[model samples]
Target chain A: MQAKRVTFPNKVLPYLLLAPQLAVTAVFFLWPAGEALLGALYAEDAFGLSRQFVGLENFAALARDPAYLEAVGVTFLFSGAVAGLSLALGLLLALAAEKAGRLAGLYRTLLIWPYAVAPAVAAILFWFMFDPNVGVAARALRGLGVTWNHFLDGRQALLLVVLAAAWKQVSYNLLFFYAGLRAIPRPLIEAAALDGAGPVRRFTAIVFPLLAPTTVFLVVVNVTYAFFDTFGIIHATTGGGPGRATTTLVYKVFKDGFEGLDLGSSSAQSVVLLAIVAALTVLQFRHIERKVQY
Target chain B: MARRDGMVERDGALTLAAHGVLILGVAVMVLPVYLAFVASTHPGADFLGGRIGVLPGPDGPANYAALVGLGAPPPGVPPIGPMLWNSFVMALGIAVGKIAISLLSAFAVSYFRFPFRVTAFWLIFITLMLPVEVRILPTYKVVADLALLNTPGGLILPLIASATATFLFRQVFMTIPDEMTEAARMDGAGPMRFFWHILLPLSRTNIAALFVILFIYGWNQYLWPLMVTTEASHATIVTSIQRLAATANQEAPVWHLVMGTAILALLPPVAVILAMQRLFVDGLTETEK
Candidate 1:
């Protein structure tokens, strides 16, 4: 734990090694964040040349802009639903697999397969299923009775986006939750069972509290996942479609930047998104302090 | 934590219920992949049938052949097969590069003392919170400015220096006994040699686990590739698959074809998971999975 001697060369070695990565992150990430924050506060011309220092003009513009306001509302609902669903499904699966014994490994592997399938592929796969005419799901549902088309209806489109995203996260959630579950001390569980506690009770009281930190960390992560990572899928799958009903925050950012060609608004939204994430992350560290005893 | 008397009094029903839920979960998780595989086998006609065709279809060869239709056969610029190669190449490059750099940096930070060591490590972790979305325009500007657009360098470079690997490697390296390092040093092993020979090999399973995870991560990436590359030909396999969904219309997206392609994408990761299932499970128990 203690260094024998601290030489000047030794003092400089590690910093020298980390310089490349540190430099890249700073220039590409840190510098950009600072620049983007500046850009967000300023208005820009049509060609993306900044025109003036507008104070909080962009944030005010977002507050009053109908599309921006709606996007924020939709963002919360979509992200919340996805995070909650994935958490529930993932926890259920993890818990079950934990009790699967010798077959637990098999279940865990199988469960995490979807995560490895990648969001892009997952989007395509689900797109096929929800394909209007001959998509397998549409066909099967129509064959039995009910007909569903995500492309035409706004409500269905929103539902489809949530389903597609939430389903894709199941495996990733399972991977972490399964890891967290597996790490739980067996003795505690055994002791609980010996005391005649049922699985549900034991889970609620013992396992859940222990998993609070992981769950909280995942909540922050999952919220970020829903917010940021789903942009591509939403772009590829729904295209914010049927209407703008499915346009979440990042999707709106992409739309403004790439599709609408309004780099300024997109930059503004991106800045806002970053602020939200930073705040949540700070809250996570604070929460982690209380929960992550190990 | 809770009173379990009711469950014990009821005998083994709780166990049965637990297994039941577990089995059901396993089924749901595996269902899509199975469907994709089966759809890959069947002719385009009955691909959507309710009847579960567990066996491979006779058209497996034709489907795969159709997929990889090389040269002038498919009558297009290219088919789906090449994208898989691109995905693999990109994923492998990113995985290897990220692993090597992170390990070296982590080794430096953990074993050797230097000014700002803690600060440097913290700076790396800052990226973990800063998802690619936050700095999309900046990174896009950086990549586009460098003219790295549509190249492997463009796709892979942005992810090469990851905080996750550094963070994980630091944690792993911190666990190594310093006594071993001192012993190696006493025997005339210099810092570089000691790190290369001893510490690296000692963390074999950790490295392997990370490599597999990273490989999957790269293979499945979408947004970054989509942003960097303009050419469909240059697209990674996942990109191509996503492009297919985008281009396809209201009709169920040629479910059979899309799912078949998905099956192709799933193969490498599934194979990795299957091959390294034991190591992964062990890694989970001993470290963070």
Candidate 2:
């Protein structure tokens, strides 16, 4: 955060150092974004070569389109559910593992293994786990004579998506939360107990407050992952399927860009999605990240 | 230690239930993979027959061998081994290139008093915000323009140079006392020498952390690779498996083969995490100064 007077050697050196990164970013990131914005404004035919500007047209289409509306609804539900559930589960597990004392590290290690698996592969794994015909759940449920159908029910599909998302996230959050919990002075909890405060009361007054900042940061990261990264999971598993029950915003983006090849409309969707995420991130930085404390 | 009114009983019950749930939670997390393992060892019939139990089957060796040896080609697609190899090579190439570039850039920024360091750092930082999806199409064109599509460069070029690694290594470097840097510089160590001998050794664990994460990121890659590569020959393990599943319209995918391929891709990153378990833990556990 401090300023150092930079020499031309320093000046050119950092640029030279940063040049490849900048080119990659520009080509891969900035260019696509700018093109997406432009694509949003202009209609493009197949082959992505032909184009014509149609101001606000794609946005209008997306606004009124049934698929887009449903995608928006599902996106909100998915992000909200995944974010909240993962936080609660992560915090609960972090508390459990942290309290295990000497075994905390090992427990944490094994517990978070799910997070280390690739997202697409994990989705595939869950697909097998949740498959109505072949899944462990299905087989075991039938073994107990309790029948379940995840494919038919919209809620079931969304629930599985949320669970899958949370499964990956809980481990990730536990990493941070366990560290946060470990940082809490044992003397404080000891003093709370010494003062006759019960576990629940002590957590409510002290431990929860101490854990707040970590929760806030995790919320931001979890929500971001929900928005962007976990789409592959949903794409692989539900495919915004069972009548588009699980399609999120990113799912729609993929549908538009790759599947539909409606670059203009998809680019518009991307712009809107990017705008929403950016604004939320700015909110996190301005309000939450600031309020978070050690 | 502080036993008042059977305090162990009170806290102990909660801990008991918590461990119960935690153990259950871990199982719930791991069981599907367990299924994958079991399924991988059995024949396609047992899997498609919806047999969940791991009744001893003779398919394990056959399936793993077929997957590893290109034993026989499926009807529409090629054998699995070459496809898996393509993915393996791509992951390794991307991982190695990314590490080299990131280390050089991270080193230059952390140790040198070069100009525009802040600007250069921030520029790279911007890429972290603009993830691959945002830049994906433009990058597709960047590759296309360079005639890199279907080539490893198309995959490797856009994939290299992470902003996260730069930030992570910078965090590690910042931990080293300035006196050490001064001492090394005073020994007339030039920039590259100092970076190799002094800074690198001190931050091996941090580098390992970056290696583990980056390798997993590269190895698990799906979307971009799917887009960049249009042919089956170029498919990564993910793509090959997806194609395997997609074509099994009348019957389920050969479960053993698919899971075997998944496990193959699963091995490298899991190994990185398991082998570097201590370093990964310590890297994450190290206190921020």
Candidate 3:
């Protein structure tokens, strides 16, 4: 809502500047979103020839559909696992890098480059490593007396996708966690040390609590990444699994609409996903504002 | 003296522990890539018959050359040379396009007032959340209906309307002293003149940083390109690599070339990140903030 006190008086230039962004948003984002909302209200014949106005029918059908429910459950499980795993691993890596002293920069660079790898590529790399026949890691695991076949087993397939997704995300979380660590005043840690507290004690009493804001922010981001961005991993590696085991909600939307040609249900799912993203964005914005005020 | 010695010993032990953990972390981070690179160097079908050799092979040059079409085309796989070009074009377009539009829009929102000004900002802001994956079907329908399918504009335009870039630029512009603008106006400089001369140069670092992030993002895109292109000629390295993997599974499983393509798919973005490491980190943290 704020603008420059000594602002330009040219009323026309601002509109011109806003036009391109507005046009793209309207055509690409807003219009499609509107169509999704509208399409969700109607069910079309599979042949795409006829349609009937069926208010809330798609929603009801989604509710009744066991596969949809499974997808939702799987999505939540996948996201929660990703968020938790990435955050914990990231925090650990960040803490280690902070303590790494002369090697910190090298460690940081090495650790963060994975953020640049494509999710699909990351999945492929992992798939190769875990390939039942030739995968060295899989062979290693088998040597330890465990069977590893993602193509045949649904849980293994889900786990594979989760790891692939979480692996790509760890770098993002690590960067944030490391930044948060750096932002913490060193004097607090020194003071704790002077009070005879150990490193773990200092972290628990002083550092971890101060990281609350960063943790919250990363939680939303990591969840969003897992929920939406990992579509590449699922699409490339598992294709929603040996039996839909790895099909997150976003994946289901693509599968249903594009592959299944069930436009109505897919649009309804998109609406649901949109609502979720909006809610997360609102939460993130509120937190950001609060952080700024702080 | 004894207490000092004890404190020194404890610090040394802690630092050593830290180094140990970091080394392990780095290994985990680098292991897959290292393995993939190793796998790419092996002769064809090596993954099928034996434990994948952990070390590099003699065929690295031939495999990579084959991947790029310098050698014979790997059987059952398309050359990644043009796919990489498509990816490069898309990435550059999205990055440049997003920055150009976002800079203008952020300038307008920050420096001027107009009807629907807040509404426009909010509208663009909403797009930060509505990524293409969520609205795939309808968005695809929009693209198809417009007959923009398989076109570079189709791949680039829809994605360039970014909230993060707009917000980043707006934040940077707000930090510029109001006096700068006032002084420019006092000199009878027009709005375009002020923006071109003052704001553009001042925000160079922000733009550069954002360019790095957006380029990586655009290059790594999979789902949208997969949906839009549908033509092999338009395929990005990322999507094509996946297709190669799928095909590999269905038939002979061209492990060597597929691994090579995977390596190629990741090379540009990783190179970009490493080359602009500081800016990438700054851009990421700042934009997220």
Among the numbered candidates, top TM-score falls to 3
Worst 10 residues of 2 chain B by lDDT: B1-10
Whole-model lDDT, model 3: 0.90
Runs with alpha carbons beyond 4 Å of true place in candidate 3: B1-10
In candidate 3, what are the lDDT values of residues B100-181, reduced to their tens digit? Answer: 9999999999999888899999999889878898778888888899999999999999899988888889889889999999
DockQ of each: 0.42, 0.40, 0.62
Off by over 4 Å in 1: A1-12, A143-145, A175-199, A283-294, B1-10, B42-57, B70-72, B75-77, B250-255, B281-289
Q: Write the per-residue lDDT of candidate 2 for residues B196-218, one digit (tens) a residue.
A: 78778997767776666666678
Model no. 3, DockQ = 0.62
lDDT, candidate 1, B1-289, per-residue tens: 2232232243366557767887787776666566667767766666445433455667666766777773233222247767888999999998898888788788777777666667777788777667777777778888888899989988887877788788677778777776787787778777778778987899888889888877887887877888887887788877777655543353442445666677887788778867887665455433332
| iRMS values for every prediction | 4.7, 4.1, 3.2
Q: Write the per-residue lDDT of candidate 2 for residues A156-238, one digit (tens) a residue.
A: 78887787778877777778788788788777877788889987888899999988777777777888888888866776667
Model 2: residues with Cα > 4 Å off, grouped in runs: A3-11, A47-50, A142-152, A280-294, B1-10, B54-58, B70-78, B108-117, B180-188, B284-289
Total clashing pairs in model 1 = 8
Task: Give the lDDT of residue B186 in candidate 3.
Answer: 97
| Chain B TM-score for all candidates, comma-separated | 0.84, 0.85, 0.95
TM-score of each model, in listed order: 0.88, 0.89, 0.97
Native-referenced Cα lDDT, model 2:
0.72
